[model samples]
Structure formats: C-alpha cells, structure tokens
Target: MDLDSQALNMSSRADLVEFLGGLADSFATHPERWQNANLPDFLNAWAAWLEDMDGYFQNRGESVPTSASWQLIAQMLLAARVYE
Candidate 1:
C-alpha cells in the first residue's frame, strides 16, 4: 500500500482493458465476493477490478496504494476503443 500519488501516468488503453478483464476473471473465481455485488449473486466486482488495476499499475512501474490512483485507470478505460 505504498502508492505515489504524483506518479499517475498510465501509458495506454490496452493496459486498462487487460486489467479490467483480469479483474472480472478474479471476481468470477471468488463466489464469496459476489455476495457484495449490486446484482443478485455477483461480487461488487469493482474491488477485484481495482485490485487488478493496482497490479497493472505496479507492473507498469506505478505503485498505487489508494483509490485516487484509479482515476488514471478510469481515464484509460474511457479512452479505449470499447468505450468509444
């Protein structure tokens, strides 16, 4: 949980998509997490979503330890072809 707030530079949309996909996969594997999902039986999913994102950032050299770091992830996702 040692995130550097000032270092919020996500390189590309592809990275975000990959992160989200991994997050979805993790959520699917953890049924207990689904209890918190807004849907009937799905996990909130955002938790795993965010965790995968943190991992993505870390892999990209950005040590994200807070929710504030998610803005960059959101932006990247918004900029992706799927979102468009």
Candidate 2:
C-alpha cells in the first residue's frame, strides 16, 4: 500500500471526512489485519479486495490481476472500518 506515498487530496469537507474516516479505520484495523483476528472488517476488506481485483484488470484491459492497486488497497482499508 502507498500509505507513505503522496498525500491524499483532502482540501474539501467531503474529502477531509473521507480521509479522516479512512485514517481512523486504518488505525483501528491495523492490529487485526496483522494479528489474524477474526474481525469482520478485516475479512470484509480481504474478500472485497479479492472480488475487486477482477474489476481492476478489466478496467486496465489486463489479462487478470495478481495484485491490487492503490485505489483498491485504499478501498479495502477504508472499507475495513465498516464494522469497526
């Protein structure tokens, strides 16, 4: 993940909220992701990211995806906060 890469655009209210939410979600889920906890948020993100891989490939006209994009990763991270 590009967590240490360029900053996300959060110049507006909506963007700020999205960024804040994503940030908090990531913080809450970090331990679970690495600790192998049975958190629904973690599992949900894992499954969602896997399911979303195909779309990434389709969008890029690639054969198939063996990896996730920053966007996909971000989505997963952001989504991991659903049940947090």
Candidate 3:
C-alpha cells in the first residue's frame, strides 16, 4: 500500500486509535522479539513525538491525525526498516 496516500486518506480519530491499538497488541504478543528488535526505544520515541504533536495541536486548537495515522506511520517505518 502507498502509505503516504493512505495516511492522507485517514479522516477519523477513532480509526487511528483502533489501528494503534492493534499495533500495540501485536507488540504486546511478542515482547521478546520486540525487545530484541529495540522496538521499545522506538516506541518510546514515537510516544514522545506524539505527545509533542498533541501539544502542538492543543496549542493551536487544531486537530491532530488520529492514532490510525500513527499506526500507518509506524508500519511505514517498519517496512522501510527505519526501526532497524
């Protein structure tokens, strides 16, 4: 899938939240693998980035991309081996 296009197409926060939840579940089920992959550090950085985005949106009274966007971004990063 063209993640850039897919990310632009996301229109709902709920959908994003669902997607993130699924990604989190995937990670949860394979703790050892994720840890070995250093996914925890990546996740922590991602979380911090999200917090910054959230704060930015809050300050501007603008909407942030839903968790779905984050999920898609995470997937794209994985696909690109950015985490590695």
Which candidate ranks first by TM-score, i.e. highest?
3
- Residue 63, model 1: Cα distance from true site in angstroms: 13
User: lDDT tens string, model 2, 1-84?
Assistant: 233331344345566556656656766768554543556766687778777878876887977834535586578568967946
**Higher-ranked by lDDT: 1 or 2:** 2
Q: Go through the candidates in order and give each one's C-alpha lDDT.
A: 0.56, 0.61, 0.65
Clashing pairs in 1: 34-42, 34-43
Stretches of candidate 1 exceeding 4 Å from the true structure: 1-10, 39-84
Query: What does candidate 3 score on TM?
Result: 0.35
Q: lDDT tens string, model 3, 1-84? A: 233454556567665556666656766776664543566787687688777887877787978757445577767667867544
Clash count of each predicted structure: 2, 0, 2
TM-score of each: 0.33, 0.30, 0.35
Superposed on all Cα atoms, the candidates' RMSDs to the truth, in angstroms, are 9.8, 11.8, 11.8
Error of 1 at 48 (Å): 16
lDDT of 2: 0.61
TM-score ranking, best first: 3, 1, 2
How do the candidates rank by lDDT, highest first? 3, 2, 1
| Inter-residue clash pairs, candidate 2 | none
